[model samples]
Target: MVTRARRNETDPDLGVLAGRLLFAVQNELFTSLAKEGFDDLHPRHGAVLAYLDEGGVRATELARLSGQHKQVVGTMIDELEALGYVERKPDPADRRAKLVCPTARGLAQARAADKIMSAIQERHARRIGRDTFTMFKAALIDVTDHQRRQQPQ
Candidate 1:
């Protein structure tokens, strides 16, 4: 048996609730970054930043991982490069290809984002018991892993 919250009044679909929670978390992260003087950063930038590898990644690979168009990723990379967050260097393996790598400022921002995410997770654990939150996260991972395994490569 499920009980509805007074504010929500009714139960939301699981996917809808998940999406809302994700957006809320992202909004809070962006707000925190803005307060810390990263005012120019936007939620859309996460598409590129989140999937970036430590060494570097090719623009086309980044676009595929980010589920964004190649041109769009290229533009975002250009903006990030201008902002001193990332750099484009010629890929050693491919003379004509370029790899996007994070700069010192970008690494700092990544650290800050990690801290913010940890704080958010701690808050959620406190709100819904640590054990429950752990189980919930594990369940989500399992579901995603299962879906990934089922997909054709």
Candidate 2:
């Protein structure tokens, strides 16, 4: 059996490293959120919650921002609505369009998530030095942007 210690002998590929980082951070964030009375939320909900704003956002925009298909985003919206995290309302600019507006509970969750993420980043920055952490973030963003640009339109 290949022990985890033995696996560390070789450098991980970019995807593995990225997945590890993502899942680790998500685990910490969700666990903390659950402790704070948001036990109903899961990591998948981030596709919708991450882009929500007070002014309300269109479901199509959420799909675009989240890189999810419109149908998937629509389903997520339905789930969030059922959970009392959001509501569908008429768009002020377009009567034919519906806007997804965050509920008070959703806003509270967003606030908590922001605080938690900030603390997590701060902890990592302190460990690696703020300047290095900043550089790392910039490099990561560059890599991600390059990858996105490479995708077929």
Candidate 3:
């Protein structure tokens, strides 16, 4: 069996760089939110919050959009409900189904997250030239769109 060659320290892979950046941004946003009186909110909760609709969305749809297992999203919704961020109600279209809705507090949290993300993007643009940052974002969007298109529905 042939051993894989070691990667150079100075040239990290794209996945490594992406993970590091994501972690840093999440940490900063969580800390900022905590200071704004949202101490109960955790970065992982973003998986659900990011895809939430203002009106409401079904639990199954949330799981699909967040790329999380139904059980995992269910647990998260329970926690969010307990925290007064979300509530489960009978779906208007189908009474048999439940919709996960954001409370006023949850809406505030989403707004805060958006603001925090914008600030973080601005910081990145400043550190890496604005053009470079724009290009990076475009490349990421292109890759994500391509991959999404390739995935089986």
Candidate 4:
């Protein structure tokens, strides 16, 4: 079972609820750039960037990771490539496959962004307390794990 989420709560002050949620998301994004240095990145780039950060992967694998069509990943890759965030190399494991890896700059940005995100998360943890934050993270992980496991393998 999942812990109670604010989504189910009917807020007496709609403006406050909306503002808080929006502020949190905006703050996190800005915080990411602030700690990482401003970069021309879009949120959609996040899914792909995270995958590349893990390790080099084939284009098709990225498509799977992003839960987007192969063509969509191709488009995203084009953008990342244009931005010098990633480079593609022919996959030696299989002919006719290309693997994407982050550039040095990309790696640096990823590390910085990771720090920023961690800081924002820490702030949230301070607000909710470690026990609540732990439960929240565990619940989120459980939800995602369950959903992913349900996907066709």
Best by TM-score: 2
Better of 3 and 4 by lDDT: 3
Worst 10 residues of 4 by lDDT: 3-12
When 2 and 4 are scored with lDDT, the better candidate is 2
The TM-score of predicted model 4 comes to 0.74
Q: What are the per-residue Cα lDDT tens digits for candidate 1 across 1-153?
A: 555554344667666677888799889999999887777888888888887766889999998777688999998999899988899988999989999998988888888888898999999999999999999999988986775577565
lDDT of 4 by residue, 25-99 (tens): 656775567556555777667667767854578888888877778888888889988988899987878768788
Best by lDDT: 2
> 5, model 4: CA deviation in Å?
17
- Pairs of colliding residues, candidate 3: none
Candidate 1 error regions (>4 Å): 1-9, 145-153
Across 1-153, the per-residue lDDT of candidate 3 in tens digits comes to: 332234524566766777787799889999999999999988788888888878899989998887788899999999999999998889989999988989999999999889999999999999999999999999998976776678766
Q: What are the models' TM-scores? A: 0.79, 0.92, 0.85, 0.74
What are the lDDT figures for the candidates, one per model? Answer: 0.85, 0.93, 0.87, 0.76
